[model samples]
Target: MFIDVLKNIVITIVTVLIFISAVEIMVPSNKMKKYVNFVLGLILISVILSPIVKFLSNGDKEIVNSIKSYEEIFTDNQNKFKSDNVSTLKNNGKEDTKKELFIRNFNKNCEDLLKNKFKEMTFKSELECDVDFNNITFNIKKLRIGIADSKVNKIKKVRINKEKTDNKEENEEYSEVVNYISNQLDIPKEKIEIYKLEE
Candidate 1:
């Protein structure tokens, strides 16, 4: 490679010198000849140093090319990261929708089951649950049941100053319902709450 470069430099110098000599011979006046010779001398010097200058500047070209390549790679990685984030967001939205659907279905099924067992009572249920997406497991946290007896049309009003009293019959009925729910759903009674609904 070094030999080839040297050969090309020598050939360029010789060609430039020959062209300068031809221009010098064609000069019309002695004063113009002096100016032309000075210009030709500068051209000759440039022709001789061009190979060395090009060799030094070659590294700069390589650096520019390398920087451009790195920039392209960085842009590609950035675009990929953005796309991955967008896809992850979409997946999260889908999971949220699925979780909501599961909760709604679970609440409806529980209400239907309770309604079937207690025909004289209407049951409205609200439940809180924990779902593990990775493991695909569900844990019921709390279950709230609002019970309204179909036979009762009006709720009795109680004064705030009156002493609190427990109705044994109502307590026993609530306990039985709680026990039945615990046994059927495999849920602890402590997590279940039964409330009387006012009409």
Candidate 2:
């Protein structure tokens, strides 16, 4: 590129110089010669500088194209980075929500189990409890039981620990139910509450 531009510049300079010399020799009047020389000088200057102007114009396009390509690459990279970050955030949010939901459902299932057991033993009751989960495993947090009375006094259950003898079967009552729950849930009696309902 430099060589071609240099050659063009040299050729233009030589041609303009020769034309100026010829015009200076051919012109007659001194005043006319001065005017003609001034014009020729201007023309010579334009011709000599034409190669540089052409080079600059051509170089401007190449420079602009390279800068444009670089800008496009940078924009593409920025967009990809942003997209990846958003995807990670969404996945993390989903995981946390899923974990919370799992714990909630497990607690509900525990409450239902207790309700079923109470029903089977003919004990009309309502219960609530909090469940503990660590690393996706279930444990107990707290428990409460409610018993309603029908125009009578309400009796609360007492927690007991005893092994049944093979010779005798036991009748189901408040104490038995409390013991059953305490054993089944592997929770202390302090964590289990019994509410007595008034008629």
Candidate 3:
């Protein structure tokens, strides 16, 4: 609607200017020529301004609609962005939980496998172990050297032999056990430690 009014105004101004130019060429008196030119200038300005005034009518509605559309688009995009962030956070939390569970299960399995292997050994000894987070420290916290035979009597003889234990035999036995553990578990020898149980 506004464009049609603007185009008509431009055509009118052009037509009027051409007519004035043709009249000015034919006018005889100089004073009449000046007055005619002044009237034509005023007529041209009014023609141009008339369309501008019409363009301002009902313009507030269009402006309001434009602003509202932009705001709606912005709000939609903001909501979408928030939802994407929430999903990513949820996925990250789930991934972390999965990794923690896997690590915990792996540690438990290692403990069970090592315990069963210890029980299968020839000596009747009891040992408890702990492995580090990086699997670099395998420590034997408790090691009971000998097991008592089952009997009905409650009373027992306590023998304290300070000098009778053969160091060579004990070292060989300890070395054999350590080598077997290291080989079976495929863990480094430096990471393993043996300790006697506290009475």
* Highest lDDT model number: 1
**Full ranking by TM-score:** 1, 3, 2
Q: Candidate 3 on 84-125: residue-level lDDT in tens?
A: 999999987876676566556644655455456565433333
Clashing pairs in 1: none
Model 3 regions lying over 4 Å from their true place? 1-55, 120-199
Q: Go through the candidates in order and give each one's C-alpha lDDT.
A: 0.81, 0.62, 0.60
Query: Which of the two candidates, 1 or 3, achieves a greater lDDT against the reference?
Result: 1
What's model 2's lDDT at 40? Answer: 93
Winner by TM-score: 1
Off by over 4 Å in 1: 1-64, 153-173
Cα TM-score per model: 0.59, 0.39, 0.42
Q: Model 3 misses residue 189 by how many Å?
A: 5.8
* Candidate 2 residue 186 C-alpha distance from true site, Å: 4.9
lDDT of 1 by residue, 21-46 (tens): 89987888878788888999999999
Compared with the true structure, model 2 gives a TM-score of: 0.39
